[model samples]
Target: MFSLPIIALLVAGAQAAVLTLQSPRFTVSSSTGSQLRSEPISLAHASSIPVTLTKDDVLKLTFQVIDKESGKGVQPHQTFLRFYDQNSGEEGIQPIRVTNGGKAKFELNMARPPLSLPPTSDAPLQVSLLIGSSTYSPLALSLFDLIVPASHPVPAHPDEASFHPLPEIHHTFRPEQKLPPRPISALACIAVLAPWIVLLGLWGQVAPRAVHLFSPGIFPFILTLGAFESLLVWYWVDLKLGQVLSYGGVLALVTIFTGKQALSKIGDRRVGRK
Candidate 1:
């Protein structure tokens, strides 16, 4: 009778030992205009999952974790959920304490703050559920891997041109408008070349007398010039005034330091002569 009880306990312990956990399926709830939409998602088809959310849209995801062998919901205390962005490297962990039929829900606010760029549509994010003890065996269920969509879709209009036709123009007999003068201003050209001319003059004047001074300044000058060129390109192409001003401020500091060093070297040469 004692051996039979011990064998029964061993069998019960073997049944409780977890080998793997089932991947959770998700249901997403989103609102489009005045209508609310709910869609089911399978973890097995995570690679093809489409994330369709616009700015200021609210998104909700719900899923449940279960044991692979028993096909039963895993206990809340034995599981935890982790959400992370693969591109931004931002991660958040939540304890799994589901009160409703072993289902856990996560909510996300998709509103973009003022002056902030929207999240990249191509960037991937993941939600995973981990199970089992930290010291021994553990299993991870990749609940969802989805790419966020950045922009809202434009509705197609089949006869838009027909509805909004171009207006007719009338030609007036008047004197020909005077065209602007050809070629850029000479002052503008001088302003552009002035920095380069100054740098070249300083190099010529200081390099022969104090080779050490010139060599040390060369690397910084080149670096500053490179940064300035990059800023110039950014200004012309992107037309971002804030970046241009910030970079110009940094370049100004570097140029001031270079000028001070050059002046000091010239003073040293004068002192030696005297």
Candidate 2:
């Protein structure tokens, strides 16, 4: 058995070996079995004539990966075929399977295009082969330019428009409503308060007797109810409706409690007199 250092050196030397392809060739055929083109691929340069395929045509490629010095077939760790649409800036990589003996074959049928194919345009796709291995150096070869029928445009989603930024809202709000002249505003305010003012002016003539008006229990009920009214007035002038409602709810509870106590006291006093 070799020593550890010697074995490591041998493995490193083996991994540094160069890799190449053997008998790289492609054949284009019709669905009806008639061959349109058949030629061996050159690793030095890509083909000048682009291979064209119609709706039902098929393309078959055959190649074998080998060690450059040993000339023996090698099954690499990874192999891939890349199709790139130069104009569309779209590309796709399709993994290729190499047999244990390093024999590899790929077939492209236009009848059912592979998902790895990029959406194509009028421009030809630049085809390339890439192979990687742990034992040998990686290799890349530009194959041939391929021209196929343009793919149908991808359909848009139903909510595609919702994805885009919305147009800015330029609210055309009514210019701040100008207030009426001060004298007119004052007159309007007076008009609104006119009935109350008149009613207050005639209070002495129409005022009725309220014997329990100042009774301690009854007066508290009246004061709580009055506070409720004041809360409403505040809402009309400065406070928001929600705040007024919240305050009114609390005031209503206080008013109910006071009214109940006043009624209870009156009943007890009446019972005492009877």
Candidate 3:
């Protein structure tokens, strides 16, 4: 049978989706600089991209701007970024002005939306940029439509300690570049997951409080997930298993709360059930 943690993870994870956004490329000439040098910048790197994060997940958005003229970095005067809910027609996420090395580095952290309250599914959020008081329109709206459906739970404040990294994006960006290889011995994984699996099983046998299982404490959950990923990193194995297991653990908690009602449906089929 699948462990409770694994089940919980899968249940929440299955709701996640990939989101991407691209801005438009523009050439800002001094109108009469030296040698008339031109710089190259990608629309993909300049705009705020939509990201789905579960509570306590930390997200960092990096934008690199290169100057072609002096073969150096180009810094803009002031960079303003905004996050808007396309569905609600309201601004959702906002950040203070970003200055990269005293210039427009074009990179900023996409702070997660406030979650002191509940999240509404009515609106889809998007990021935007303001350079020198001019609103630079993004390329095609279709370009920046990355939407990871399941995000980490929002915290009272936006800080790294309260964030979890996204494994899917990590894998996508570094293709075929497995941080760690598969464990030579499955025993190691079994050993690691044993305790939680047992707890999950026991919970299944004696179901617990529903609220305790699904409470809004995404930080601890994400921290635990990060620890699992860190273990995989140390073991020199791909973290895919850990990622799935992370969510699986959560799902298991959910199952335990539901009196194992979903067990019968999941009994015969599980992604990596043993």
**TM-scores for candidates 1 onward, in order:** 0.35, 0.53, 0.27
- 1-274 in candidate 2: lDDT tens per residue? 5569888877887769998999999999999999999999999999989999998999999999988998988999989999999987989898888998889999999999999998888899999999998767778899999999999866679798789986788879888988879999899999999998888878867887898899888999989988988887888899998898888888888988999998898898899952
lDDT by residue for model 1 over 1-274, one digit each (tens)?
6769878877766655553433333434444435244556554444355555555566565666555566666444556666566766656565656643455665654664222222344566576666665322465667566445544433449776568876788997898898655455666778888999889999988866634534664546556767788889889988688878887997889877875765566677679952
Span of ten consecutive residues with least summed lDDT in model 2: 1-10
What C-alpha lDDT does candidate 3 achieve relative to the native structure? 0.43
Give candidate 1's root-mean-square deviation (CA, Å).
29.2
Q: Backbone collision count in every prediction?
A: 0, 0, 42
Sort every candidate by TM-score, greatest first: 2, 1, 3
lDDT agreement with native, every candidate = 0.59, 0.91, 0.43
Stretches > 4 Å off in candidate 3: 1-50, 66-68, 92-97, 100-120, 133-143, 146-274
Q: Which candidate is the best by TM-score?
A: 2
Candidate maximizing lDDT: 2
Indicate the residue-level lDDT of 139 in model 1.
Answer: 59
Could you tell me the lDDT of residue 173 within candidate 2?
A: 83
Give the true-structure RMSD of model 2. Answer: 12.8
